[model samples]
Target: MEELKEELLSTDGKLDFAIGFKGTVAIGFQSPQSGYNLKVIRNTPTEQYKWGVFEGVPSVLEKYGRVHVINRTGSMLDNIIFYRVKLERAWFTNALLQELLNDASECVTLQGESLFFRHLIVQSKLIPLPVYLENSSQAESEAAIINLGHCIKNNMAANIFNKDLDARNYGVGVFGGVYLFDYDALEQFTEVKIRTNQNQFEGEEDIPEWFFEDGVIFLPEEIESGLRIPNRSLRQLFREVHGDLLQVDYYERIQDELGVGKVPSARVYPERYQIN
Candidate 1:
């Protein structure tokens, strides 16, 4: 285990030196791995702590940590990207850590970054939602959704500068009722609209419909051009981490209420040089 720990913390690859949970144990190797234990939890970094936020407001949740190590080879990215990796940390417990290890291995293999896999560390103390739940109810469900939205909005407002909330990344727990746990796709911009402008579509495109059915904020052009890259990316990440337990379509409906109309494609896909 110590050797494995050293391998993960080594600076020979694209990983940026195990940023969170320094000096933690590696419990992932002790259990039968599964997808339920592999997802990354999201938290807002505070001004005092390396990752801090306001107290008592419940700003922490589980999320798919963005894959900063794109090609492996010990390289790292300076901006947000859509990818996630597997890792094991003592903080995740034996069962959860094993799942994370297995999932990370699969992710690295799929992305063709097997060499860099050696450096992946399952680090952090953030807990999972299922492990925290006690019961289910309508009020609990509503609170969960609201809290999840707030968490997503808070993170977007603080880091990515966007208000586009992806509610699918959140789930309901027993005590907290609702919580968020993925962050691999988080951006540092104010709005997803600023990054891409092709989302605007003809007629009443129904952006909320896409959110309800897809659990994402789809731009008009993204649907028309069949370029659902963000959707595909997020689906891939969560499917691997949560298996089929996540209810995707339920949240898509919730997003449909953000208003609808023909929006300029440039507002959603700002970088496209040519339109079809």
Candidate 2:
């Protein structure tokens, strides 16, 4: 079966023009009733390559069912590309994706060259967890953190890992569950040994003493460092529920699971990705 369709986008899907980066993914419309905000991928070879890598990622995510992921993607005139997934929105919805299918609705219009389409758009109504945790109760924070652990476990069980495992890369979905949205560093580890920090600390030595394996990155230690939030209590709460992720034993169980009989269906990916 063919993996990608060669159909020409209505025009914007081609992304022949650059988009303005003046705004972050956060949604802020001048009116409360303003139509949905779009997150367009800048027209650049780098973004195109990155976006290309994500072509089938959403399909894989859809099978996970409960996981929040980008919803749909396609192109319009000018080769502009767009995704039903907005980088930032007050709420997540699948309307954008479905709208694209209705030729009569004019869900979006290509007014000029400054905007493009996003095949990387999503249908998640969840907000970023870190931002939510900042204004929420300790209970909420703990729940988010715990749910995050669940999210990680579920994804890993499916044989995938987010190398950039940062808190911002994840979001709390409309269902009150945390899910990952970023794919810039997604990878598989069907046989890769999880990387761990060496027992020694970094000192005057030029090279950091962290351990390294052939192609896999140990994610536990990095999670503690990268996913840690600013709130003291939230961090403490996460420690209570997921402190194991910072240790080797946490990964040992996964390693053992894979060794015994876990289906090794994932393709082994390189530790580093090279853009050619």
Best by lDDT: 2
TM-score of 2: 0.54
Give the lowest summed-lDDT range of ten residues in model 2. 71-80
Quote each prediction's TM-score.
Answer: 0.31, 0.54
| Clash totals for all candidate models | 52, 32
Q: What is the C-alpha local distance difference test score of candidate 2?
A: 0.45
Q: Which regions of candidate 2 deviate over 4 angstroms? A: 1-40, 43-120, 191-193, 201-214, 263-276
Write the residue-wise lDDT of candidate 1 on 1-276 in tens digits.
343335445523222212122211121221222112222221222232322222321222212234233221111111221233334332234443343345344323322322223233342223232222233354443343334334433333223312222343334333353333343444433223321343447575556433444222434222212311133433344335333213333223223322232111111111121287
RMSD of 1: 18.1
lDDT of each: 0.30, 0.45
Q: lDDT at 142 for candidate 1? A: 38
